[model samples]
Target: MKFSCVAAVALASAACGSGDGAHADPDLGVESSDTGALLAHADPEASGSCQLPDGPRTVHQMKGPLEDLQGDCVPTWTQEELNAGFTRIRDERMITLPENPGFERRIPWLAADNGCEERAQAASYYLTNWDYTTPYYARVLVKPNKRLILKTDNEPGGSVRWTHHVAPVVRVDGRLMILDPAVEPEKPLPIEEWLPRFSVAGEVDVALCRDHAIGDGCFAAAPVAPSPPQIGDKAAGLHLRLTAEWGVQEILGRDPHRVLGDCPPWVECEAEPTPDENRPPTIRHFRTDRLESEVFFPIYVIGDNFVEGVTTVRVTGNGVDEIALIDSSTMRSILLASWYDPGEYQVTAANGAHVSQPVVMKISEF
Candidate 1:
């Protein structure tokens, strides 16, 4: 019921804990002293202490609360210990596409473009399970029209932008150090250095949520939630509570390798590096579903090198042939399945003069 919301301007340091014994009262609407704003509507479903059982977790359950509120429950660990823990988690980054044959263990780094929330939640579970320390999350919520641009080698153009970002935080040598491997792969970054990376000319609101649910609570507690006009969408909020097991399994409920889609809001399912437009479109995967109405159902084709209006999709075979260009992204495209007869068909994507190799799709009679 207790969390800290710090309104930060130009990355100035702000205290991150409640000392006044303030707790959110559903009826009266508790106002966070830090933000001086009434607490956002609490999720009626959120209840009980935000703590979990000690040791490794597997089942999904409400986490129990931490008992160390005297110091805001942030761990006081040595620099060496902090760095070691950071490295241990950082090493979990996947070196290749998660689908690659040899891909191994923790953290989907390749899905880094817009999966910050999932990544952070997964990290928190690991930190707790490894016996490193139970950690709090540092959430940076940006204002309208601003972006948290992070330079990275993971995506094309050597950078990625975010509406907001959340990472696990630990107190090292009295300083709040961030454990975001996606941003600073080598070491922990102080909050000062970490905050400014989002925007140098703009101000952002920061909050320290005790758990995943509280992170969403922080966003709800904010004054104005920004929607980037340029992106034509709102950033997804974080809702990761690591009281169960290893972060990935807890969030995914299965092996990371077996899961498909469930992508973070920043990117769509089967998103990959933008392919060279000069080349033929590549079809990485395709997904289809049945709808009740079945009028103009969509066929989602995930791939690379797709031109918005110019690229075309062709599905042929089994007494039906269809081709159309509906909507497209560099990594994803939507083609109208239009209640095609149930049968196997060969599908190919084309951009300009180049065409992709044929892939198979089985459409069902709706």
Candidate 2:
């Protein structure tokens, strides 16, 4: 019943706890708070103190409410201590999230960033290094019998088939609040009701990773959550990725504008690099001594720089045959069949980049 929204942005400062008398209602005066707007629709299902024994630790334990949560999985550290990972919990919610001073801070959640690792790390570094100190949590829950990534246009994608989604949850009072700081603004909801938005298209593999930051005692070998080695998570990495890509402007400037960014609204500012064309191969000589055969025959092609791999020999003059590479290191020979129209065929080779000069191949009905 006590649903509140974050009005102001969370301060990137040290952890400041709320005392026993710190209990206060949501800042209803927030007219256009991004988080406040989303929290308005919050429908809490379950309430009361946590029943489970091991978790939902006190706010004092978690430092502050959960932040920096992601829906996808990206490896941050290998299985070692040097590269530490956050502890994660699946399909569960923490009961006691502290209302630290930084709780009210609102972080802008941006759209997709193409699996870039460096930008991801810089964000995490900023969050951890900054003054804002909140004990971020990782809650990884896999939605079973839900739609996962499906294949599209010869490329495998998970978002297309993603009917259900997973995220991290922080316990406030006695209820759990979902912190999906990647796509949507931070909105707190119960697990039962929260599970519906992601309609089960199929089964999905989801993980909630928390960032211990750096030198916080968490390592790759042993993470907080009982999950895989989380790389770039929403908890810290995502928050930062969004910031570096776009949010940083907001952190320093008043108007958080995206001239061109990864998410929607801002179109891609830069164009993708076009691949350079390969140099055409120089055909020194072509053995035009073979007649049409029923099966297949070899055409010896002597040339320079006939790509050892992925180089195909194409024949196109009177007729054409599907070029298949037999052995293309020193001597580039191709297997030619007799299915083409009987005439003078020009044989050429290509390595996906450059095309080789034409060689004469005379074929007759033998």
Candidate 3:
């Protein structure tokens, strides 16, 4: 089922690439090329949309050993239990919700039959039903396969729309913290109130944010910038450099200890070169006219060191036919580039026309 307005707004903000032995083979397994097909067949009625497919509703459920249990499954709670349970966890221990003045105060409810106890229960139902969990500090970990839906009222200037997005949460003080890419890309939601509204299906672990350091659990697993390149001996008449950057943390918390090997004594820290930096000697040109009329920019990354991905080129004004990726070193255009080292890159059409951003090839080197 789809998320309510609150959850939709919450998730929209939290929000990656590579190259060839160039082995241009794509990791089609992780790639959601078929997601479009699955979405096409998805039940819209489940999300309160008229265009939904007719089928058994796919309720979001947690996987793993703790899937069936609820809230640690304690039979009895003493004073200590009451103190330690989510009820006593200070607001400071979780991520805060965003305040959007533009957001409509009243939202349509799909499952009014299951009226939530409060906003927190509403939020919980959205998350838990979708197999998403918001632990203590509004820190949420979304499974890659999950899709969030948001259906708008069909009125003038209102059309039912859906988007796939993600957001990460952090906790500070007695409030919830959020790092949402859609609302505040760089800035974080340092403080906000979390109202529990939904009944969770399984054992949802809500920890006190005070238990962990700020920005420790959530974004820490995200990809980090690689170190600066080290000058190595030149070879084959081409400059050979060795650079080290950090990749995505293994997310051991998501997997079982037996499956993922023993948890590291301390979080593992390793570095390697990024994909774009490892481009082959030959240069090629790749261009797309998808965002022909809009002002768009190409985002590329070298390592975590840079702020915005390298803005190779910017298309200004309107009606621009194509954008190309060229080699700065050789002044040659790269028609088809491969990406092996996974990172985030995009060509955004600010004007919003044809928003088709296809995955380029991925290449790896020995």
Candidate 4:
């Protein structure tokens, strides 16, 4: 079922790519033309609307092995990298358009009235865009009977409750840290520090869903089916879903709340955007044309917010191969020549000024 919110509780606090010259060949299983269907342009008409999908939800497994969340497939970062990411994503909060304060072109981080899922997703989007690895969602889910409550000044009653709460999580030096700017704007919090904000911390179960696991497969071994809401139950299951079926669309199509209905009477603050508003492109997911790693095939890089005409793709590690922009909307095509040696390499996208976190791609006939 859709998450529920209550106006109770006391003082708790808180909170692109390029392409190659590969064509749309279904037999090859690579479609450069399909990126348009995936692109979710900003909705100017429904700017401030914060409507989430209705009904029961399903939490699917991620694309990579579970070890990725533990830093096996994902890269770990230093504390300095963590600070840089915190600054970049937190600064993207939507603010100040005299006519419609929420009309600003950024995530509405400052307003915590509702839309935790959207805030988490948008924060993850910006994190991956800032040269960091794809961050997963660290969700706290409780049995149907109990509600997860938090004390915060942002809400009208100085508190808010939900069936579940989520935030972007990243791997830093072997630890998973929560990046919830709305709750803890000053810095990133380790999972240990994050759990205390909610009243029912001991009652909820936590789950991690990678940003790429849009559909089923990653958690097939132990899946959480959506259940009807009940009260006072103590089941270790969570009803969760990625919200959006594809990448980028999660942020754009969802139309996260730009302005909270119960926002405190604060003036329309001026948009204090950072000097570099143009974010670097991201590499959300990528795959080779063929299943066999030994064979030479074109690689497809799918992502969002790519800067057209300027974005470029490249692979490095065992070998170096550059790719041309195939479709600027949200995908890139890389034509790997047969002569290049085959081995595991990191694939990344760049928009001249910024480079995205790398996704692993192997081109060997193993």
* TM-scores for the candidates: 0.44, 0.25, 0.18, 0.40
- Best-fitting candidate, measured by TM-score? 1
Tens digits of per-residue lDDT, candidate 4, 139-234, equal 665554777666764432366566556776666766778888667767899877777777344566665653212211122211122112111121
Instruction: Kindly give the stretch of ten consecutive residues in candidate 2 with the minimal lDDT sum.
Output: 13-22
Better of 1 and 2 by TM-score: 1
What would the TM-score be for candidate 3 when compared with the true structure? 0.18
List model 1 lDDT by residue over 63-119, tens digit each. Answer: 211211222344456688788888777664332222343644345444445545556
Q: Rate the local accuracy (lDDT) of all candidates.
A: 0.48, 0.31, 0.22, 0.44
- Give the range where candidate 4 is weakest over 10 consecutive residues by summed lDDT: 236-245
By TM-score: ranked, best first: 1, 4, 2, 3
Residue range 217-335, candidate 3, lDDT tens digits: 21111111111111122220001100000000111111112111222222343433332322322211122211111111322212121111232332222233244343321112212
Q: RMSD, each candidate, Å?
A: 15.0, 20.9, 22.3, 23.6
Error of 2 at 292 (Å): 40
Model 1 misses residue 20 by how many Å?
31
Worst 10 residues of 3 by lDDT: 237-246
41: Cα error in model 2, Å: 28
| lDDT tens readout by residue for model 2, 156-267 | 1112333222343443443333434332322334433443444331232322223322111111211121111122333332233333333222211112222212322222
At residue 246, candidate 1 shows an lDDT of: 20
